[model samples]
Target: MDVPEALYLPDGDGFTATALTIGPWDAAHQHAGPPAALLLRAAEQASGIDGGQTVRLAYDILGPVPVGPVQVRTSVLRPGRRVELVEAALSAGNDRPLMRLSAWRMRSRGDAAPATPLTHPAPAGPEESRPERAAFFTTEVAYHRALEWRFAAGTFNGPGPAIAWTRPECALVAGETMTPLQHLLVMTDAASGISATLDWTRATFANVDLSVALHRPPRGEWLGMDAATVHGGTGAAQCNALLFDADGPIGRSSQSLFVEPR
Candidate 1:
């Protein structure tokens, strides 16, 4: 029998984050990536743009979101025929704010916008890449098991810049189909982990914000992040990743980090 995937079990307007949603840093804290995807889900629902494509995804993590039940509320900030802006907020118990997210969705251009050439080609396929070491993450993380990862360059949680391709090991929500946009959101938030510029043993590097800009929606089940991180002496850092599908570059994602010595 296959292991159950670490994803949400929808409960009305809320969802429960399972063991697979655990983060590497804190046992009680959930990973920012999964919540970010959930935020996108709520935003997409509010936008009511079934045929729309996400052009930008922004996430502001206010604090560590405790694992367990959480609720999402979404609203349309700006309505447009060709474009729309939607916002979502994730709250923990007692409706405490944990994260705020915004997305810009636009009608598909189809052929109006000519296809741009790929500046970054697809890296090695998932079969050719290596799995991240088990010891790299101390605390059990849901993403580690929920997703399949293959590194293209550098080392897994090893050091400087690296590239890793990833795909969902199982559904993000039990019995629910996840969209391409949702998959991209989850993987993009891992920019810092994919490439670390700081020592994990001596420092805590957490992303406070995440932003993704896509020229076109990603295609294929496999998505990759060519990532790099930079840390300043002033306890601040940032990670950037060029995202790709199996074909080629699809978009880009970035995160602002909070770096502090342990």
Candidate 2:
């Protein structure tokens, strides 16, 4: 079989997941990134939201999304001239939703004042970094392989915080160009795994939900994350990341984790 060039292949009203969607933890399931991006793509294409941009996105992972055909349904939850709420759901066949996303889209005032001066300086750009692979990637063809990773601060398997730059090697869907938010969303879901503090072999830390808030549309192909995970001993954990582009800081992302010993 030939390897797919994109993460997903369009199928009717749904999409077919390719090997590129597989995560490090499972070959049969998909990493949250691609599916999240798909949901956002659906929302962005939905009617009545043409003039606005998504400012916030929250995802609830109901279950492991199987690596196969999945349907995406999007609707406008609350309509407004200045702001709107959009919802999207992904499901396999008639099964319950595997993931659900709610997004807030707001109109941009092009006449607004300049953005506040960036307090924290930008991290080292991708040109100043070296390429590295994630230590936890066990599968030959997985989501990890779909991105180009260049670390500016920490290694993939190293404990504590990490600062890294990532760019997608392929499109989210074949024949489609990914928007800036889609690019950022596809990389933000890995914040917890890349910045894990627990031993990968001894324990499992999987994020149950992901939320992102952006102050401005990210620019450029490379997106940066300064990420860290905090485990609270009681089987619950939180991961946070300051999102960036080559120009400067753009937003923040966070995930709620379900931690357990293997």
Candidate 3:
């Protein structure tokens, strides 16, 4: 499927979205339907913001989104004078909320006050490394054409840290134009958890909650992700990542994951 067309799926109703189940995790795809991406699009469309502008998107996965039909409902929390605040919830049967998201829409204020560039060095590009098919990446994630991902280090057996590079195939979805934030959101899942990537051969991981923050828009189309699972012991794990553009680091994302032995 092409990037634009692949980003969303068709519900039995007129509304189209990404199906609850797609490649890799077997769970619903994030930012697919009733996901963060859908919320952002609905807000933009409602507020009459051309999908090309900048809007901050955040998602809180309260629980598993279940595999089945879903619907998205959006509300404008506060249509501010300078900024617009919007909230979206995804529900299955009876409108039970599966995911709740809020977006901050505002006109670009341009660059921030000048400061020294002290970000970390850029990681190696995906092209420099050899390509390998991850069981999750190729089958579950459905990222085949959207990104050129390479697992820098990790065993296929168990939970642990993993590194990979991601570059978007298409811009992002917002009406008629693509935005940089869409690229960041699409690749945020590249290498999620540490325990899940370990070579132990008997661990499983699923993101319970995830969020990404962008400091500056991506300079180039290609962005790299360096991710690690930090400290999680009591049935929970946290995955953190730094996003890098050609110039330097641009954003970061982290997720709280549920861990168990398969």
Give the best candidate by lDDT: 2
**Superposed model 3: Cα runs more than 4 Å off:** 1-5, 10-23, 27-34, 47-56, 66-69, 137-146, 151-160, 169-178, 193-201
TM values, all candidates: 0.94, 0.96, 0.74
Report the Cα lDDT for residue 242, model 1: 90
TM-score between candidate 1 and the true structure: 0.94
lDDT (10s digit) by residue, model 3, range 1-262: 2234444554664244343224345444543322455555566666634333434567777765554556778787877656777787877665678777777776555575774595654345656654654454424434444455555455323456655655554333323333445556666754463225543235666676667676666656666667777645687878787777667777677787777877
- Residue pairs in collision within model 1: 20-142
Candidate 2: misplaced stretches above 4 Å? 120-122
Q: Cα deviation of 170 in candidate 2 (Å)?
A: 0.5
- lDDT (CA) for every model shown? 0.82, 0.88, 0.57
Whole-model lDDT, model 2: 0.88
Q: What lDDT tens digits, residue by residue, belong to model 1 across residues 224-261?
A: 88999987778898898898888788888888898888
lDDT of 2 by residue, 13-85 (tens): 7899999899867789999999999999899888475667789999999999999999998889998888999
Which ranking of candidates, highest lDDT first? 2, 1, 3
